[model samples]
Target: MEKRLSHVDDNNTPAMVNVSTKQTTLRTAKARSIIAVNDEILALIENGDIQSKKGPVFHTAIIAGTMGAKKAGDLIPLCHPIGMESCDISIEVIESKIVIYCTCSVTAKTGIEMEALTGASVAALTIYDMCKALSHNIVIEETRLISKTGGKKDYYHE
Candidate 1:
């Protein structure tokens, strides 16, 4: 069989994938995002988190990232709305880069890769938003899926 875009119909109209026929299983996905900050922002980092005027940077990002994962279906067109089991966001500072990881799990007919990706992306954005006042040079370097499981196949990034 040939592989094609799952969210497009034979008539070339965009549509949500019909996951009702798919088997319900425990699906999980992990995604990563990297944010690069300048020395000014790095200087303010006291511990694992940064204190911003908006509040604790990492703490606010954790809440926002979790919300983003739960709301990915609403944000992205043609994505299935899933009742996710859990969403975890972890952040760490390494050198001048801040690394974020979001892991999402769901027991449903479809996988949760989008949720994981959205979570990581939002967390990275949140970090940028919180720290932009110090310097406009902050950059969200990359956002990508690290791994996914419990679908037609599984994947892991190198």
Candidate 2:
């Protein structure tokens, strides 16, 4: 069968999905965001973080990512507000790039893919914000869902 939009009604109006009838299950999603930086800035970063006047870059981004995951419904319309059981953010630097990973877990009637995606995006943005003064050459690239489990089905990229 062809896939249909879940956030629309027969009248074609945007609507929130009713997941009350669905069984509550363990749902988890992982997302990734990549930040490309120039060699100069990469040299400034020691370990996995860069310490700026504002604060430690990666550490602050991690906190922001967790908050973003929990408040995903507030940022996106039609999303069901949910209390996530876990929200994890990790950052690693390889060569001239930083990779951010966000994983969100919840036991709910709906999937947590949005939350994971939001977390990774927010974290990438935060990194850019902290380091923009050093150079504008930084690029936030490839915000994508890496994996998702539970709900009606599970998904994994490659």
Top TM-score prediction, candidate number:
1
What tens digits encode model 2's per-residue C-alpha lDDT throughout 1-158? Answer: 87789999989999999998999999999999999999988988877678899999999999999999989999999999998999999999977789999999999999999999999999999999999999999999789999999989899999
Whole-structure CA lDDT of model 1: 0.94
- How much lDDT does each candidate structure score? 0.94, 0.94
**TM-score of candidate 2 relative to the true fold:** 0.97
Shift of residue 18 alpha carbon in model 2, Å: 0.8
| Cα deviation of 135, candidate 2, in Å | 0.8
Off by over 4 Å in 1: none
Clashes of 1: 0
How far is 148's C-alpha from truth in model 1 (Å)?
0.2
Against the true structure, candidate 2 has what lDDT?
A: 0.94
- Shift in Å, residue 6, candidate 2: 1.1
